[model samples]
Target: MASSSTPSVRDHASGRLKRAASTLAEDTQSLVSEIKKAFTMVKNIAVDLEREKESTKVKELETLAVQLSESCDNCIRHASAIHTVGNEYQPTSELTDFKKLLDEQFMKLKAMPSQNDRLIRQFQEAVWNVHHKGQPMPGEEEEDIVMTSTQSNLLNVKCPLSGKMITDLAEPVRSMDCKHIYEKEAVIAYLPRNGNKKQCCIAGCPKFLQAHRLVCDPFLLTEIDELRSMNQQTEQAQNVEDFTGLDDED
Candidate 1:
């Protein structure tokens, strides 16, 4: 009789674990979906780099991003189809622990794109190398020349929000989330009027957001100043252009 009861006890524990795993797998979808989008951004950057002229490093990152994306997609199918679970419902402490592990993986996935952005923003030598591939990295004097060239190109560039070419960023504001800089007054006025739902105006911005708030971005202002000083001074600015694709705002 004791031996017969031992089998029942073992089966009970085994069934509970299976149910928990199933629930955790279902919850993992939301996490994995966001991970998919981030990898897509990496792929877009890779394409842009290719158009500009590819760097070996950018290609390597692109390949890695694809591998990670496919792996995440496979997990959804594999985890949900576990054949070990019983037909009945079971919620146990085991399921709770399994869900926590999924949550940790979710955080890790979120950080991956941020890591890529940091590489682009801070270490643009990788991007410079892409354009200058075939030639040695620019020396100090060469870098100065490159800087002058870059600044000159931007002088004619107009603010995306206001078509008027910006000579100086008297009050520069960058999207806190997206990092797309716009003239302070233009964005500040646009935000509250749109129910405080501001978005990055740049084309194909990865981090466009329903901006809840705005803050001064001095770094952008400084860069604008350098560009402004390169040419004749002008205090006049053009009127804010009609915001395209924002019909819902009215």
Candidate 2:
């Protein structure tokens, strides 16, 4: 029932996530190379012609390059998150918001392939103005990217399960089996419902015991507290400076 016994769970998950990430990286590189070859073809043929056809082909290739680049980036982030959670962090399914977080992340990772395929089909059709059906590309539709540790934006950093600040920084705890930390209150709330047999929300290692025990992450908790205190002080200082500036203007 202790978090210390979950290394095997993390190790197995790490291997699988790494393999999947590797495959994705290889596939992306191959696709990018093909697109580059198309560029070479366009350049070679354009040298002998005084026609707009060459320009059109070049522009198409450029647009496809941008799209593929974005897709590749998203794939990498998702894979990286998977590896972090699977290997470095554990997940607890018992928390109220844990599954929701995973579902959101999964949707994004799933979208990458769709976007890639759509772009490929677009390239096959014309590569420039893709006239296709079904759902549009992620950016095209204006869907917001789900924030996670993988993103650098400050707004994205939060408890993965609760989608909120780790308010209980002093008493923060983690289900070691999954390696995910949660506010103590949030975790305790889950314990009453299922007792000590809750399953983890992580993709792999769905054992109930992983969610049954909780560990106080003092080091992590202290770090979170320091960040919170720093932000609070910064905000207070900014407010005072603004007040002083207003007085001077008056």
| Candidate with best TM-score | 1
lDDT of 2 by residue, 1-250 (tens): 5577576676676567545644554454455445445643543343323144456655555565556545544544454344333333343433335345445655654553333432343333232223332344445542321221112212223554565676445466666455566666665666546455765443464544333356442223323543565467458768999999999999
Q: TM-scores for all candidates?
A: 0.30, 0.29
What would the per-residue lDDT of candidate 1 be over residues 75-158, giving only the tens digit for each residue?
543343331122222444343454445455445444433223322322244345455643445554666544533443232256
Q: Which stretches of candidate 2 lie over 4 Å from their true place?
A: 1-164, 168-170, 177-179, 191-209
RMSD of each: 19.3, 15.4
True-vs-predicted CA distance for residue 239, candidate 1, Å: 29
Candidate lDDT values, in order: 0.49, 0.47
**What does candidate 2 score on TM?**
0.29
- On lDDT, the candidate that comes out on top is 1
